[model samples]
Target: MSAPPLSLRWRRRDEPLPAVAVAASGAVVTQLGADALMRVTAGAHLRACVGREQSWLVVLGDEADLPWADGAVYLGWDGGLLVPTLAQPWPCADLLREPLRRLTKQQTGLIALLPELVLAGPLPREPLDPARLAPS
Candidate 1:
């Protein structure tokens, strides 16, 4: 059978989210709903997203457009970077490379059964990977 679709939670657009603020301070986690809700917006719009923005939404298209974001790190069930790595250069992971792009890179469980990560922070110092640990 095919894998289940990934679960994504997002905040309402009318109200701005505190993602950037938290990023500026630090990134943390939790399992419970009330626990993780802070990752996204408090209230405005929330739902399961087949796709979510890692950062903010510029809304280039309809609401159907993967919760379009101006910024945020999106990860599919398999953990591929959602938005576009077309021209962005990641510090360690050459997003252009096949292996890096295909694998579930840094999409870890922090909040939202899965959370869209957005930040204008510094690129990682080295490749943040744990490939050897995967079962082949």
Candidate 2:
């Protein structure tokens, strides 16, 4: 099968390694080209190539934070193009995993990340306490 067409965000290399790390663990990404991302700190964004059937994400390490990149172009496992920055948790994440995995195995796509703030949505109308935002 043919890989998905390549599209890069502006200044992908200029971005910090932390952003890349976020991408690795945020979603199902696969790296394309040579494994030249070793210089990137652990859990970096890891490279990938867009495949025909799937958009693969290279697993670098654990997700340091939210994986959504402001201008990043993500192809979900189901052929959905998502700018993860706008992704909502819950069904959105679960829905995306399917397409992401399927596409990765086929297209082998690559992702360059730009970190951003992510607000986890609460269940129903029960607002979460700010104190619980992080472990003290």
Candidate 3:
């Protein structure tokens, strides 16, 4: 089978989502993690991405975009992070990477999911020119 198409979305907190269009390169992800989200946004040169709570701004597209057909693994929000239930499904192992499993409850669950996005392969790392990113 082929992989589902993925999408990426970002916005500053407590503000309206700008109508900015991204390149067709398909940078995208979920509770959407904070660190991973900030990293990408920072790379995109969104000002102040790392300065505030960014989890909500980090929408890795619809939750449905996740490989739920493989099956859903129950996770919980503990302390400030997402904790998986003991009944972990082996098939969906890709959903939980090493960094996520090691996160302390004190941390945001969003931070754990960043490595997976990075490991998905190299993204367009060249700095984006601000002029090309003007909102429609």
Best by lDDT: 2
TM for every model, in the order presented, reads 0.20, 0.21, 0.19
Ranking the candidates on TM-score from highest down gives: 2, 1, 3
lDDT of 1 by residue, 30-71 (tens): 121122232223322322211222222111111223232223
Instruction: State the lDDT at 98 in candidate 1.
Output: 40
Report the C-alpha lDDT of model 2 over 16-117, residue by residue, as the tens digit.
Answer: 223222222222332221122332333343323222232322222223422343333332221232233333333344454444445444233332222342
Candidate 3 per-residue lDDT over residues 66-135, each given as its tens digit: 1121122323233222323332222234544443444323222343122123112122334333332322
> Model 2 shows how many backbone clashes?
36
lDDT value, residue 69 of candidate 2: 35
Candidate 3, poorest ten consecutive residues by summed lDDT: 20-29
Q: Could you tell me which residue pairs clash in candidate 3? A: 29-60, 33-110
**All candidates' lDDT scores?**
0.25, 0.30, 0.27
Give candidate 1 misplaced runs (Cα > 4 Å): 1-27, 31-42, 47-88, 91-97, 105-136
Q: Is candidate 2 or candidate 3 better by lDDT?
A: 2
Give residue 43's error in model 1 in angstroms: 2.8
- Model 2 has an lDDT value of 0.30
Between candidates 1 and 2, name the one with more favorable lDDT.
2
